[model samples]
Target: MEALFLPQIQQRNGCSPVQPAFPTKVYNGHSQETIHLHPFMIGPVTDTKVSLTISNGPKTLQLEVDLHDTVDQLKKRIMQERKFGGSESISLLYENRELKSSETLGQQNVKNQATLFIVHKCNGG
Candidate 1:
């Protein structure tokens, strides 16, 4: 009824859906005016550590890692478990995205109990 159309009306009025109440700074509106912004540090996010499952065909491996660990670090850990001689031959896939080596677990948006696909990248013959 009215509830259904209310959201549309809010959107038309430019109301943001995902807005957090953060403090705003004042603007002097001058090129010469130097504005320094202090880094706003929020509280630590819960569950800094996460357990990820890597699915490789019939076999699956699970490992616990810190959110700050880079993808290359995860690759090394997997290398220890599997006989993949080199990590270069293998690739990690998450939701159709090929994970980069330098990206951290948090940067890649990896969550707790998340499953990643371990696949072999076919090279040009």
Candidate 2:
């Protein structure tokens, strides 16, 4: 009987080690069958930008943004454009629900030409 030694697999970046689908046949310190490993590929990002209308009181601001942008990113853009002071906190609302800072616009279903209400708050006295 011949002894087969498998290579040590290590986990990276908190991800689990990849497990083989089935047992591999090893012969004379070499794999008898060819093991094809394909690199993980991510799909290309689209350049499509959605137009969003932000309503704050009687004033409305038009913004064109990518769907992948998070709510915090959008708020930063608004702050830049409006020259909002650091003391002001901005909140975005869609359909009466507050948008989460960590969530993307696409995840929240904020489509093109969508109207988002902006609520402003002063941080301190």
Candidate 3:
């Protein structure tokens, strides 16, 4: 039928697939599987709260961080707790994920009580 061939031709022509006016979701794999995600938040600063969780480590701490704080500040806080040196490399994780150095908690959409994991980065050459 024309309808069947039209989609193929459109694909060959590099045309985007037709989308519904309203948002639609299609599962590529494990469509029937249901996932339950626990909610968390980031805190400490008064302004700009983020909802995230840090489950990267065995022990999890729930707190809020101010978006105004830079990645360096966060590292410093973690260092104070762990008592690491100034030159040591530290990284932050939001929702069990790594955060880009340039990104702030506010920019990344973090929320209250979001668990953030602070880890040290090891370099060997």
Best lDDT goes to which candidate?
2
* Superposed model 3: Cα runs more than 4 Å off: 1-56, 60-64, 83-87
lDDT of 2 by residue, 37-91 (tens): 2234369856558999988777788889999999999999998887444537889
Give the clash total for candidate 2: 0
Model 2 lDDT vs. the true structure? 0.77
For each candidate, how many residue pairs have backbone atoms clashing (under 3 Å)?
0, 0, 17
Name model 2 segments beyond 4 Å from true. Answer: 1-48, 83-87, 122-125
Q: Per-residue lDDT for 12-118 in model 3, tens only? A: 24445444342333344544432322223356636565444444357544445677666666666565655344657878877667777776667766667666776
lDDT of 1 by residue, 22-83 (tens): 44343434443323423355898587799999988877888999999999899889988864
Cα lDDT, model 2, residue 73: 97
What TM-scores do the predictions have? 0.59, 0.57, 0.45
Of models 1 and 3, which has the larger lDDT? 1
lDDT of 1 at 47: 75
Task: Note the residue pairs that clash in candidate 1.
Answer: none
